[model samples]
Structure formats: C-alpha cells, structure tokens
Target chain A: MKKILTIAALALSFMFLTACDSMDSPSPLDTRASDTSGELNPDGLPGDATMGADSGLQDRGLNSINGFDPENINPEDIVYTIYFGFDQYAVGSSERDKVKSAADFFAQNPDMKIVLVGHTDWYGTEEYNMLLSDKRCRAVSDYMGNIGTDPSRIEIIARGEAGATMDVAKNSPEAKKDRRVDIVKVK
Target chain B: MIRRVFLGLFAGIICTSALFAEDAGTIRKDAGRLNVPIYRVAITSSDADTANLAKRAFGTHGSFRLSAPSQAQFIFDFAPSGGNSVKLTIKGGTVYEQVFSGSNSVEALMKACDAAVMKTIRTPGYFAGKIVFSYSKNGGQTSEICTSDMVFRNVRALTRDGNDSLMPHFSPDGSKIIYTGYYRTGFMDLLLIDLNTNTRKVFAAYKGSNTGGSFSPDGTRVATILTSTGNAEVWTASANGGGFKRITNTSATESTPSFSPDGRTLIFAGDYRGAPQIYTAPATGGKPSVVRTNISGYCSEPVWNKVNPDLIAFTIAQGKGFQIAVYNFRTKQTKVVSRGASTSGPKWLNDGRHIICTKSNGANRQLYIIDTETDSQKPLHTTSFGSAKEPDFAYTAR
Candidate 1:
C-alpha cells in the first residue's frame, strides 16, 4: 500500500510539472524555411520567406524574371490552381510562385490574357460563398498586379459554390479542394 | 392514493401504445382551412394512352381525388378526335367539353389532360407549367440547369456553358430564367435567358459575386445578394441588371433573398447571431428583424407562397438532415410536413396548398410534390434522370 501511494504521488507531481511547462510556453509558430514549390499554404497566408525584410516577392516585378514564350507554353502544362484557406483570401508562398509564373508568361505574350475563376466549397451561405469566391479572385488579381501583370489581362469570375472541387462533406479536407482559384488561360 | 396511481399508470400505457399507429394525422382534420373546393375526379377514355396520361396528371392533385365514376362528383371523358388529338368532356351537374389538339405523344397528351383538369375545376392551373432545377453528373463534379414540365417530360437544357450552371429561377411572368453560370474565365456570372427569344445575356458579373437573383413582384427590379461592397449584402437592382443598390449590411452573411407577395419586404437566410436563421428586411434595404416563429434550429432557402401571403415554406436542418416546414402567420406555429425522409428546397405551387420539394437520402435526391393539406407526397417522375433537385414552380407556360 505504501509503495502504491508513493508511485501515485510521483505520477501526480510529474503531470503537474508537465502542465506547468505547457502553460509556461505555448507552441511556437512555424519557423521552417519557406517552401519554394508553387503551391499555397494550408493557412492561406504568406510564408516566412515571402514576409522577410526585403526579399519578399512584392519587391520583385515580372520584368526582373526571365520571360517565357506564351505561344509555345501549353496551357495544360502551365495551368495551376491556387488554393485558399477556409474563409480566407490571402496569397501564400506557393501560390505566389504560380502568380509570378503567370505574370512572366503574360509579359512575354502581351496579347494573351489569364482568367482567374474564384470558387468556394458548399459550406457557407450562398451569398457569402459568392463574396468569398470573389475575395479569392481579388487576392490573386492583386498579387498578379504586384508582380507586373496588366490589370486588363487579369479577368475574374466569382462562382459561388457552383463549381465545387470535392462534393464530399463540408469543411472537410476534401471540401477545401473546392475553395480555390482555378487559373485558366485565355487568348 | 394507491388506486389513483394505478389509474394514472394504466392511462400512460394507452397513450404510449397510440403512438405506434402508422399514417396517423396524415389527412388534415381542418381541410376547409385552405378555402379551396375538394373535388373527386373520375377519368375515362377510349384510347389507352389518353386514359393513362389523364390518370397521371390528376393522381396526386392537392385539390382533387381519384374516385370511381359512380361515386365521383366530376367525370372526365376523352375520345380520339383525329391524327394526334383528343376531345375531352367533364360532366358534373353541368357538362363541359373541349377538343385538345397536338397531343400525338404521351407527353403532349398528359399536358393537355392536365390543362383540361384544371380548366374543368376552375382553378389556377399549374399542371401544364414547367419547373427549372439543377442536375449534376459525374458525382457532382459538373452541373447544368434543366427544365421539365410538371410531370417531368419534355426536358430541355438551357445552358451548355461546360462550366457549372445552376440555381435557375423563372421570372414572374415565366418569360425568362435567371441563373448563375460559370464561364471559362473562372467566375460565376448571373445569366438571364429569355425563353421567348432564345437569347441569353450576363445579368451581373460584378467584381466580387453576383448571385441569388430574385425578381420583385412588380418585375421592375431584382432582389439579389452581391459581394461587390466586400461583404455579402442583399441588394435590389433593375430587372435588366442595372440601377444596382444595396439593401442589407449586417456583418452576418445574407443569402437566398425572397421577395414577399407585396414586394415591400424580403425574407432571407443569414447567420445573424452565430447560427443560421431567417430574417426579414425591407426590399429597399434597411435593418433586418429575425423571424423567430416556432423554429429554433437553422433555417435557409425560404420561399414565399405566391397565391397565399400568410404562409412561408423553408427547409430546416435537424440533426444530419433537412425537412420541409411551413410557418403559419395566423397561428404562428411551424409544422413539419414531410415525414420519413430528408427534404430540401421547398417552393409552393400556385394553388398555395401544394409544394415542390427535393426528397433525398444523401445518395439520391429527387423532386417530390408535397400537398401540405393532406400530408401526401408524390415524386416528379423524370424519365431516366437519376438525380434532380432545386425545383422552382412556374404558374404559367411561357
């Protein structure tokens, strides 16, 4: 009985110490090197590399990068989607690369245009979904403009929960597939 | 005290056993509350096709019942007139006769028979009208707007945009259909299709979102929810998609704005207080008041009764499923009219007693007409169409 009591007291002390440790310092934010892959962060915000003092993509215009031949570039190969977090409209690190690519393509082919279709999952109010989708398009448009894509070349359409990527349950990881900006190429 | 306790226990047993009865209270006790005459109809025809078509049209009528000719108050008689036409006569205490033409096929004949039934009964007819709803294929990856007659015949595809097209609503006069269609450009634009002209145009493709377009009673303005102002708000603009103005501005998301019969007010679904509830505001735009009748859970997709202004039909979400419910203004009581199945998107027909709603079990969703007066439901039989939803009833054939 004495031994059992001693073990119980030690276990309680250890749990208390662990709880104090957790309360003393909360989990730090993500601090890894920013991903350079052309994709969006699940959190729908810019990565650490894109937020630093002077190395942000906003400072680098399309003219700074080597332009590509838009005519030779197959739309199926160059086309990519930029996903947003739930109810969010911010451009993340990965999506920034795709926007830069689109800007570069348009720079080489001035006559071409890129259409950004905004969509949302079947989760919120239909009206709110429309607005959410439009916000996503606006976020992409602003990013394109920041990178030197002509405003005339960027056309936005907001489809409110009409074109959902995943028809599964709402707010699930699969449903997030629907809340994205589908980038299509236009001549 | 012992004797009283025994009696109370015995009475509780009897009440609990009564709950086991099936189809109890299916037929409403106060049928006269609808103020529409109930007629028993008997159909007879020399042609097998005509007889079948007539039965299908009046089988689930809200104000009519199928009965034997001897007991029926009215009898419908059909005879083949010539190549693809029939003459119909309805005999009650008085005799009424008419010749219907261009009914070569079952589809055409059913429509003519439905029109004849309504004309004979002297009620505003909906049997010959059309319904526009959304249909999805490839596991809902792609959707299109489709319209069919009341019996789900003569279906026609309105938009072949190859993107996603849905939420087709007929105009007040049934001359046009307003819906949202996704273009290749990746955004949804409100498109209006003129049925009379076979022409379509983009109604509102605003910077943000232009959707939920509903016409006012006067047909001069359209009440819609737009995000051009950075938040979802109800707005009214010209029927031609000009003269745009904002109506509601709460931080909460507003959607599915339904104009009342008077066009003076609009009822919409919103999460005004953290949970979805129905709220009403002026059609011209102003502060909204919550419509808290008897519903306590989330309610959305509200539609006002066109003929009767006293009742509102909406879909209420309850524990993993939705049910069609109607709220009575006079009694302030909400009654669940659909039973044993999940339902959504209830729209009242012109009769004000029948409603078109989607009955689904998550796997297959089909449109079913629910007669609120009798608590009976009949599926809208669209041939070979696996799934259909979001039914909007039109009173006239435009």
Candidate 2:
C-alpha cells in the first residue's frame, strides 16, 4: 500500500512541476518593448533614455529649445498694440514712439538684425492685400533706413490680410491693432 | 503480471502522444523557410488535387499548402500571379479553381505578373527624364530663376540674389540653356549656362527686359522678346549675343515666344484681342497674325513639336480647370490632351510622341507626361509635394 501511495504522490508532483515550468517561461511578445509613444524607437529601452538625456525628446523628435523657451520669454519682446489708419502705412505719433523704442533696442545690439513683417486688414482681394502688405513693409524698411540703421541688416516680409482681422468686429480695438507691423530680432 | 501490463500501457500512451505532437507541429516548405497550415480532406477521382491547381491557388499566388493525416504537406512552386483581385476555391485539401479580376487588361496583367516573378521589368528608360525651368526662389516677390525636374524633383535654387530671371530657352542641342536675368541696376543681360560643364557666361547686356528667348533649329541665332523702346517686341541675335535686331513693334504684352521646326517663323502668346492668345509671326521683322479664334479663355505658352511644326500645343483654362490643348495649324481644330481639372506648361519630347505638362490637384502640382497618340497620361516622378510650374523639355543631353 505504501509503495502505491508513493507512486501516486510522485506522479502528482511531476504534473505540478510541469505546470509550474510552463507558467514561469517568458513569452516571445514580452521580449519586445512596448511602443507607447507610437514612434519607431530603434535603440530600445535604456539606450534611448541615455541618448535623449541631454535634450528632452519632443513628441515628433523635434529638438526642445535650449534657453529661449516660448513660455519663459521676456515681456519686452511682446508689443501689445500698433495702430494704422485706412490705406496708410506711415507711422502715427503714438506708434512712432514705440518704433523709436524698438529702434533704440536694435541700435544698442549692433550684431542683431530686425525683421519687419507687415500685415493688413481684410478689406481687399488677396492680390491687392499682398501689394498693400508690400507697401507697408517698404514703409517700415524706409523708416529704419532713415533712422540710420543698415539697410542690409533689416529684412522685410509681407503677410497680407491672410492672418489679420479676427472673428471680432472691425470697430473693435483688437481689429485696429491687427493692421500693423511686427518687429522681431534675429541673431 | 499486472505490473508489467501497467508499464506497457504507460509506454504505449507516451508513444501515441509523441506521434500526435509531431503531427500538430507546422510543416515547412522551401527548405523549412515557409511554414504552412496542415489541412486534411478525402481525395476522390472527381475531386483530385492536380499539381497545376496547387501551383495556381497557393504556391504561385502566395504561400499555401495541402496535407493529409500523418502525411507531409505538399507545396507548389509556380510563377507569381498578377491583378489586384484574386478568387480561389479549395476542395479536398487543395486549390481546385482560380479566377483573376482587376483594372489591368489581360496582356498587362500577364506582363506585370511576369515582372513580379523575374523582378527585372522596368518602365521605359526615357520616362525618368527631367525638364529645367527658371523659377523664383527668393529675393523680393518675383525674383525668378530656378531649375526643377519635370515632376519637380530636386528643386535647386539657381539664383537667389534678387535678380529677375525670365523666359528660359533651351539650346537646340539641349547642352546649354539661355535666359534673361534683370539686375537691380536696370541692366537686362542674356545669361547662358552649359548644363554639363556648369559654366556661365553673360552674352548680351542690353537695356530693358531682354526676355522671351528661343533657340533656332540650326542653333545660330536666338529669337527673344525685347522691350527696348518701352514696347514689348520680338528681337533676334546671334547665339553668341551679337547683331541684335528688332522683329516686331507691339505695345501689347508680346511674351512666351517659340520657333518653328525650320526656324523661319515664330509663334508667341500675346493679347492683341483683349485676352491673351496664340499668334504667329515671321522669324524676321513682320506683322503678327492670329492663329486660332472663336473659343478663347486665356491661352498661352505655345510650344511647337520638333517633328510636326503644324501641331502646336498650349495651355487653356477651360471649365473649372486649365487643360493642355493642341491646335493643328492645318485644320485649326483644338484637342485637349489632359482631362484633369488643372493642367498647364505643355512641352514636347524630341520624338513628338508625348508632351510633358504640369498637372495640379488644386492644392499641389505635379508633372505628367501625356502620350499624344492615345491621350493617356502618367506621373513622371514619384516624389515631391510642392507646385512644379513651367516645364520646358530639351533634347536628351549628349
């Protein structure tokens, strides 16, 4: 009787051991890392982390801005309002003071170049808007040249009325502010 | 005796299980490279699985197999099948029937299938050619002078220093190209560039816009649209840019000039009748004559075929889109080459079998070569996502 009981016990232990072995074995799918970011991460786990440590990886692998973060930009670069009258590209008295301040900043930094991007309100066809925008840009470029700035250092771009005139009414203050030039410094 | 019987039963059970396990494993074909599912079915005389059927349904089309209980799976290795849609019927663990259906004709389908199997078939060698044109890359708004492929591949910015380059004309031999580049100092000059050598030379430094250049058949003189006296007109000069003479006196915008096969007459796009139309004039000085009439909606860019000068192809804005229409000077009848909603910039190949034109999907433009005989069109290049405008074909460079 003891012999029979021993045999049965051995068989049961064998079956249990086989089941445990099967459960402990790693799956083939688990060998590959999860693609949660939807990007083809060729180097796989720990290698990717080390390579991307210097720069935080953007969603599309774009390099993150080092020091000049858009969120942490200085308040001086943001000009809230610039007013222009109908069919006019000349700087008014109030806007001239602002432009002078911009010019002073550009003059202090000799190596810096300025980009004058002109815009117009939605009052004409696309072709005419492009022409008007050119006129406005030329006016700003001429103004900078008269103020003793190098003509080659100043770049002019015309944006036309494509991005001007928000969903608000034309009589609104924001609408008037949209018809103007944006000055940006380029290094 | 009972112990021996138990031992025998255990051994028998293990052997049977081992056999079943071997049968359950996937059977591999092609030197164990391709693993296929094992199927079992009874085969009768009426439901016989022929080798051809096996080759057609699974092996030739894609990887498939047939097997019976305790037998190795049978694999058929046949030529690759063609066509987009395929139908197959399996009977008794084998493919008994097959049918193919697709947009391609039978001959084309067979050819495609043969190509897929051999992997050596290619489109005609000449189909991968390109045409160079002057385009505005930068410098103010209209500082044109750039070269692009027929389908706008590898768009290289040739001149970007704010000079206005216009009316690019290829040399007769197609080894060199000529154009008028206007400088900021108001000096209009004729610039010539050897395509192979990449050597540039300023031939003529004339006053006003020295535009609308065309190469003569014998490659001796270049017919150009010059506005010397404040009026746009046709002029000719030696290929080396000497002995310049005015050919016409028109206050209208006389631009886009081309030469006849014999280089005796010139066809240009102008607006003498209020709207832009095609007009022909003598290669020497003379009055212009209207070529086509009745139906008109801004027709321009008249390019004469090298083989047949009587057949002139130009672009016309018809319906909601622009189309390339050919005008037979003999019949005075116009026929549309491209059926797309937007097409322009018609240029003829040296053989005159096809004309390359710019086709647009309203948002982006691509280069398409249309066969003149059949009126069938195909994309020239496979890449590029921007607008490719103004194509001018030159002869295959020697």
Candidate 3:
C-alpha cells in the first residue's frame, strides 16, 4: 500500500513538471491543451490521441482568445489624415485629434513605421511654403511623440507649394485640403 | 476794354521788370566781357495770317531773323564776324552758326539767333566722362532702346524696330554690344552686334526667355538668365553660343545675375527665401547663401562695383518708394544712396565714386547721378519730355 501511494505521488509530480515546462515555452497554446487531458498514458506522458484531441479543442479555443481574433487584427498599414488651419502649421485641436489617433495606432502596433508628409497651398511664396511644409511634418511628429509613439518610427518630408491640389486658389476648401499632413505607414 | 487795357499794362510792367532787371545783370556782364549788346525782338503779323505765313511774307529775312512772327525772342552779340560766312546749320535737331564776311541782313540775324539758342541748350559740365544707358521707352509697350546721357541728356532712340530687345551690355573690349531680343517666335535669344560694323548675329538661341545677358569679366562667356525648364535660372554659355551649362536648379527663380569682380562668385536675386533677396554662389554653380537679410523688403537688381569688390548696390523699397542702397561686405552695413521718392536700376561708374540711378518724381522719371563722396545727386539731362529710366553705366565703352 505504501509503495503504491509513493508511486502515485511521483506520477502526479511528473505531470505537474510537464505542465510547468509547457507553460514556459514560447507558445502558450501547448500548455492550454495539457490542461484538458487528465490521464497519464503508458509512455509516462499524455497520450498522443488525447494531445491530438486537445489540439483540435485548442484550435477552436484560439478563435475566442481576447485580442488574438483574426477578425480583430489591426491592419499593418495606417493612414493619418491631418487637416491644417488656414495658412498655419500650428497643431490645433482638430489636427491634434488626428495625430492622437495615429499615435494610438502606432502604440498598438509597435513594429510599424510612419512617414509624415507635409503639403501646402499655392498662396504663399515657394520658399516660405517649403519651410511651412517642413514645419507641418515636424509638428505632427512631435504630437505623435507626446502620445507615446516612438520618435524613431516617424520620418518627415515636405512637398512645399508644388503638387498643390487647389488649382492655385487660396482661401478655398480645396486649398485647405492641400495644406495637410499625410501619415503613411511603411511596413 | 478799359479794364483789359489796365491789366495788360500791369502785366507789361511785371514782364518788363523781370526780363530787364533779372536779365540785365547776367546778360550785360557776359555781353560786356564779350564786347556785344543783347537785344530782344518780336515779329508782328495780321489776324488773317499764321506765324509761318507772316515769316514767309518777310522773304529771305524770315528764315534768318533772330525773331520769328508772333513769338518773343532774345539775342546777344557774341563777337564781330571774322569773315566766316554766318551760316545756320542744323544737325541732330540742334541749330548752330559760323560767322563769315559780307553778311546779308538775314545772315546776321541768323548767326545771332543760332548763338543764343546754342547758349541755352549747351550745358558745359554735363555728360563729361559719363556712361549712357538704353532703356525700352513708351512704358515698355514698344521695343525701342532710348539712349540717355549719364546725367540723362541727348536721349536718342537707338533701336526702333527690334521688339523685345533688352539687356544691352557692353562687351569687355567695348567694341561690341550684346543683348537679348525676341525674333518673331516670342522667345528671347542672345544677339551680338558689332558697334563699329553695325552688324548683328544671333549669339544663343536658348530654348526659353534668355535675358539678363552679361559679359564675363574676360568676355569669353555670357552669363544669362534662361527659362529653359519653364523656370528662370542662371546659365553660362559661350559668348558666341555653343556650350550651355545651367548654374542654378529649378527649385527657385534665379535671375538678374551679376558676376563678382573676380568672376568666381555670382550674385543674383532669387525667391529662395520666400522673397526676392540677394544671394551669392560660386560662379561654377553650388549652394547659394544669403547676402542681404534683416530687411523684409524686396531687394533686386544687384550691380557689383568692379573697382570695389566689397561694395554692392541694389534697390530696396521703403514705404511706397524704392531707394538705392549699397551694402558693404566688410562693414556689414547698408547705406542709402537715394533720398526721397523712388529709385531703381542703380549702376556704378567705373570710378566707383558715383552711381547712375533712375529717379521718379511721382509724375515723371529720369536718370540722376548720385555722388558717393558728396552724397549729392543731379539730373543727367533735363531736356527729355518723355519719361527716362534704367541708367546702366557702360564699363567697356570708356
């Protein structure tokens, strides 16, 4: 009776050791399978049949994992639409919201990189517009940093007054559309 | 009738006093020293005839008379005729005379009239060692280059039929003239004209508006502003037009380029800084740096003083008027050369002591020479009725 009791204790400790070892592996799905299989097989391990059945159950369970659902996967690419005030690059309340959205997306996906492209209307001089474009890009980048986005993940570029979308007409809605920052996701 | 007569008498007294009193001092002094008497005369005619008709009625004397019909006239005797026939001659629309023996009544009168008109038109100290400039007149609506004396006299129209001919720069040797002209195609190209031969040949058929043609210090190449890529930029090509190299990029509007005294630096006005300001770059083409800043006004048309490399003169607008100011590279300060009103097109004389600039009096514009040492300015020529501007001092023509 004593020998049988000691053997049973040893068997139970072995099962626990295997469970802990699976938990330390890179994938947590393997340990989740062992939790469902209660029996120790003749090979001194969970039976292959039971492991296979558990894997099937794990596959079904994977779909319900929080934040891991395929349908809930955030896109690797992000588009940040920045609207500028009339003849200004100062980040206003509305533009700050756009920047915060971009930052949040970046925070959720830390592996992604962003390019902050600045554009301007055709109303001002080319030289001044070029500088303003640079300022706009920098402003967006700064806002992203304020909201927990890595500074290294952002790059700034300027298009100046060239490539204007507003047909050279200032104070128009189309011109205001031209003066904006296009945050594109690279990789 | 009585009131009219009294008013005429009062006007006669005022006119007589003004003419006799103010005129007597200078006229008598000059005449007495020259041993001559000054005279005033007028020719009367009937109501039925015109002034020319009345003069014709006087016969041969009409042409020679010092006084013409229905016109007030004055004359002064210079010297007794020294057997040189008192003949009236007109050249370039100016009248002159030479005295001779056996003078007819008409001949004597002609000689005296010629002497008086010559005295009034002739300025002794004017246009001496001065350079002239040719500008498109008639508000730039026509392609005519009008010449003005450095002080702005003798404004003769140089070219009448050549439309859009501009940037007339003298060659280094001063024997040839180079300019850009549009020939029917509406594209300005470089042209060289031999001043001695009056022969012209197209120097460069640049693709776009080739203007602001300037001769290199050695006269081997012509540096000009070419708008080849739909944007104006500085370029250098062979003076006879073969090799072309763009000196500036398409990112800016770079025009009005002036070479430094050493020809190693090119100074130009560009929109690189969001406004038209002076910038200097390597003559071989490189990054350009700002030369004039701090003043938030438009600064254009830079001319380097050949003798004083440290000095550069350009026009800057203050309020509603533009003034000519010189920037000293060493001193790092600007001095205004023009006083009130507007000034433009400041060109330095070879001596560097004076600058010829266009001065406008709100109503009319003319050329004025500003002395750097004395800070004094004087009108170059006072006879032109039409507006005159853009005085470019000729360096090689000396």
Which candidate leads the pack in TM-score? 1
- Tens digit per residue, CA lDDT, model 3, A120-159: 8754433335445656776787788877888767655454
lDDT of 1 by residue, B1-398 (tens): 99999987886665433322222213335743444455677889887656655666677676667789997766778887777566777765335567666534544455566665455444455676678887664254556677776655456666544456667788888888888665432345566777786666667656456678788877777877766555567877788656777788776778788799999999888877755688899887789998885665678888888777888988786655678889877777788888766787888888777888887654455778898877778777632355677778776532
Q: Which stretches of candidate 1 lie over 4 Å from their true place?
A: A1-187, B1-40, B65-74, B80-86, B91-95, B100-122, B137-140, B361-364
Q: Report the error of model 1 at residue B122, Å.
A: 5.7
Assess the local accuracy of residue A186 in candidate 2 as a C-alpha lDDT between 0 and 100: 54
True contacts kept of each: 0.15, 0.00, 0.00
**Candidate 2 chain B, poorest ten consecutive residues by summed lDDT:** B116-125
Error of 1 at B127 (Å): 0.3
Give the CA lDDT, 0 to 100, for residue A19 in model 1. 34
Residue-pair clash count for candidate 1: 6
Screening candidate 1 with a backbone cut-off below 3 angstroms (N, C-alpha, C), the clashing residue pairs are A39-A94, A117-B186, A157-B187, A158-B187, A158-B188, A159-B188
What fraction of the true Cα-Cα contacts (under 8 Å, chains A to B) does candidate 1 also have?
A: 0.15
Tell me the tens digit of each residue's lDDT in model 2 across B257-370: 778999889888776665568888998879999886345557777888878777888877577556888888777777776786477778887546567776655334455777
- How much is the lDDT of residue B88 in candidate 3? 32
Q: What is the CA-based DockQ of model 1?
A: 0.07
Off by over 4 Å in 2: A1-187, B1-125, B128-130, B135-167, B180-190, B203-205, B361-363, B382-385
Model 3 Cα lDDT, one tens digit per residue, B10-41: 87676455443323322433221222223333
Q: For model 1, state the Cα shift of residue B346 in Å.
A: 2.2
**How close to the true structure is residue B12 of candidate 3, measured as C-alpha lDDT?**
69
